[model samples]
Target: MGKITGFMEYERLQEASEEPQKRLKHYKEFTLHLNDADAKIQGARCMDCGIPFCNNGCPVNNIIPDWNDLVFHGDYQTALDTLHSTNNFPEFTGRICPAPCEAACTLGINEDPVGIKSIEHFIIDKGWENGWVKPQPAVVKTGKKVAVVGSGPAGMAAAQQLARVGHDVTVFEKNDRVGGLLRYGIPDFKMEKSHIDLRVKQMEAEGVTFRTGVFIGKDFPADIINWAKETISADQLNKDFDAVILTGGAEQPRDLPVPGRELKGVHYAMEFLPVQNKVNAGDKVKDQIMATGKHVIVIGGGDTGSDCVGTSNRHGAESVIQFELLPQPPEEENKPLVWPYWPTKLRTSSSHEEGCERDWAVATKRLEGKNGKVEKLIAARVEWKDGKMVEVPNSEFEMKADLVLLAMGFVSPVQSVLDAFGIEKDGRGNAKATTDGEGCYRTSVDKVFAAGDMRRGQSLVVWAIREGRQCAREVDAFLMGDSVLPR
Candidate 1:
């Protein structure tokens, strides 16, 4: 409401990016941010609707309109504070989140939606630039100790919140560094590591202790449970510290079960993406998966597949083709029908624009190879009938594919971690934990609790953050017999 008729006077503006041709040459962030004046204009476009559907669209439930108005009025410090009140890491989401909030914007029904993501990005960058973002150590000590397993967004958020509430927080990460998938699975070009480093610094300053390179089950003996300030047997965690929260991410990747699946040139997207991220982080990966001078085929048509396309192009691949099992959607959604919701439309990613031959309604039937290495792919076209897919008899074809990447999504968290604690699992192999009533987020084992992908299955980073925050509130209440943290 800075400008009563701002929505009518101004149109939405999105951030620009470097051309795909020039950006494909290197692995670095290419999106140009909106300047302060431009960001204010975008913020002004917020109608401040009576009921903000964008809030419903956001998993984190960010106070979008409030912050938008604040930024429009040149009160950015307040805008930053409002933004952080809900989202733990705007920088992370600002860069990689799909921006479902924008899709659900009220303005989207008739006009372009406000550039909320860009304004968010601008608010945070300004916060950092102006030294407005800082760690706030708790004034009183609860002396309660909490153990958070895994160092992904959920674990990190839980640890930070618990520590800020005067609890002693220790984050155990099996990886060599913090940030979990954010550190490895995501390429630096999409998000530079410095953003994560800054948060780690803030968390450390806020009294959150991080123990990396220590796999709980592998590095620590079962008997070492007694050494903790409060020994919680995986069963005792059900009884011991004030409480234990498991926030490990989902890592069980879906695989292609087909002929020649075990060939050398075929690998999972996780296997390939992490090595490049490591190399970008200065770690030498011997015998890295290189797409240079090869015909690369990426299976699956989601973000991971798009990531594979980008990585392949960066490695100077001779040719790259992406495949999707579903039929191609229309280039433009029917706005009249799908307004304010994620629509079923053809979506082109920045990587796809770089250079990729995309095909839909196609299925890989088999892998044809020689000498224990993938050399080509055999595929077929299929059409959907009723609720099933039927293959077209005459559409079988073969294409050269020196390298194949299975970009199919993850299935669940590694079961070994859950099994080690003797926690019950849901039908999907995720830790069985409820989110309401007594003992919310509490496992069947007692004081032990779970959150994030480990508890809710594989999901977005924003959802993970939400789970972490909510789980921390539950843990805090269980410890103090009461709590003030929001759910």
Candidate 2:
């Protein structure tokens, strides 16, 4: 370790962000990255823990300490290289990932953990500023063609990996552009789309072909099929490519099946979130959903609910309230002992701080509206008994709500996509493909494989990238009887 006493001397520091009032006016990233000196200090805080649990803690298994040391020593290029050794896109993870690695840091046993995410952000930004990030085209061509359906992180990583290893790779997306959820689902304020554009350019230079606005399945959801400029049969893709990989996301949103569910003011979180994103991308949306001059109620207390809260605040909502079905988590100090592994504690997001009143253990009984437009909500307090939720007697309440957003989360991948390719599905309706042992990532179909949300269901971008990389290795081995790509 370059700085043996550094961890003891330096306290952990996080990146800074714009004040909520100032950042709320525009849809752009507000969090400021660490400068050279501050990043070095944060890097110094990484203790020389022999086991380095942070490595395994990361879904991509990023070499946290090596890059941390490199950043501390002012070798930014080396640090950037180390960061890219595993994670295909540090910029994405740096901005939005919850930093599970920090939770697993040995320093986090008592004191604060190292700011590994910030250091990573600094290294990648520096590399881009110095024009160090470049494409590496394969030197020799392999007489094999690979097809990756879905241009999300998982498909992107797999295509890039296979392209670097001399395979002719084609990535297909049903959307008008690439990046999938990153391009549409994520708020531009969290991560700008330019990052994805840059990566696409690099991948293009590396002999990867991206075909957007093309639906690869014969049958698709009506709303989804409308986004595609053209359609190609799955049988055609199977016939054309030597191997195929499905990396589509889980998109079937869980619905709130209470009274007044079909009211005009009620909408899925996906319906509400992506329209704003598209408008931010300069797409004109007809009859756009706006929270201005409205009292909005967002259901579910996870990231999607928080995102809805943030977006509503940006739309100048009159009042915003979020409800959670589970009891409120304890404060960090009062959290259970099984921590660091899985932190079950109160967590407040940046969106919550913008402007929101949050409640817990509240279940929606029904929604009341006037003239087919939702205007109020009826709910009751709930308590858990024997792992079952029971409503509290005489605890019913009513509230004004001009709009109700269902942010309860997705159920599974679109079954139509799986059925189109004749792939077996797990109980969760995800593409059934294992991640270990022989035939890993290979679906029941002869040469088709699966990864990311299509295989693992709804998950983080980091996990998607990991699945893509490992799936590429197995595909390589299956094609050539051996492979050199890292898992």
Candidate 3:
């Protein structure tokens, strides 16, 4: 540690966000970063904790203390190198990751924790500015080829690792662009797509091939246009490539199976979001789902729901309302009981702060509509007893809603892709694969491996990167009989 008592001396400082009034007009990143001196001060706040639980708290197990110390000592290059050692895409995580590491920080017990995420963001951004990021082609080739399906964080991480380890890696994305969810599902206000573009360029330089708009399974009308109509059977991949890794994300959004779900203005959050991202990338869309001039109602209260609220507001919706089926969490968590772990507490997102009428423990009973389109929501307040919800007596209500977005989260990866390859699925409908023992991450069907949300179910981007990196190691070992790649 550069400064032994620095944690005691420094207070936690967060990066300021763009003002709500100013930032609401455009879908752009507005997080103000720290200056070099300020970043060093923040880095110095890292405590000399012996165990360093923040490393374990992070999904990728980043070398937090090492980088913090390096930053504190003004060793910019070393800080960037240490940060990159664990995370292949710190820039992405630095922006969108929930920063569980802060919750695990020793200083967080009684006071604010070290600004680790901001420091990481600063280090990596500095790395790019100084031209430290570059291609690292493998010195030797293993002559093994691998096909990684999905270009999200998981797939990208796996492809990069495989390419670095001398295996020929080709990433297949079904969209017009390379990045899977990162390019489409995520809003530009959180993380700009330029970050994904630079990484794609770097991966190309590192000998990884990218095939965009390439669907591996049976091509349906919904499938993006690319490559051959002949679906690459799992058996064919086994015969051609040495190994195949499926890192495709969970795409099956949970449907509100209730009546009136077929209303014209009702749509999945994914369907509404991707269009804006595409339009930002210069792809014109017809009849885009516009929240402008409409009373928007978003269902669900997680990150995706928050994103919908933000996007809807940006669309100039007249009013936005969000509903959560669960009871409202406590304003503050009981820290002593849940230290070093994520705790359930009330968290108001930047989007929530912009504008929204939020209600908890409220369930939508049925949607009432006119002219075959959603017009109003019939809902009721719920009371919880013994972990079960019961409607409150006479608490039924109706709210005007011209547009409704379902952000209830994903159920699983699209079954079509899995069915096309005849891969087995677990009880949760995710790819059947384990992360322990021999042939870890190898799907039931030989040579075919699975990672990220496809195997673990819908999860955070940080977790996706971890799974991808680990799966890459397993695939590498399986192909070469042994691997030098880190687990």
Winning candidate number (lDDT): 2
Residues 327-424, model 3: lDDT tens digits = 99999989899989998999999999999999999999888888898999999999999989999999999999999999999889877778777899
Candidate 1: TM-score? 0.95
What ranking of all candidate models by lDDT puts the best one first?
2, 3, 1
Candidate 1 stretches greater than 4 Å from native: 218-240
Error of 2 at 358 (Å): 0.5
Give candidate 3 regions above 4 Å deviation.
219-231
Between candidates 1 and 3, the TM-score winner: 3
* CA RMSD of all predictions: 3.8, 1.2, 1.8
**Scored by CA lDDT, what does every candidate get?**
0.87, 0.91, 0.90
Ranking by TM-score: 2, 3, 1
| Residue-level lDDT tens digits of model 2 in 113-151 | 898888888889899999999999999989899999999
Q: Give every collision pair in model 2.
A: none
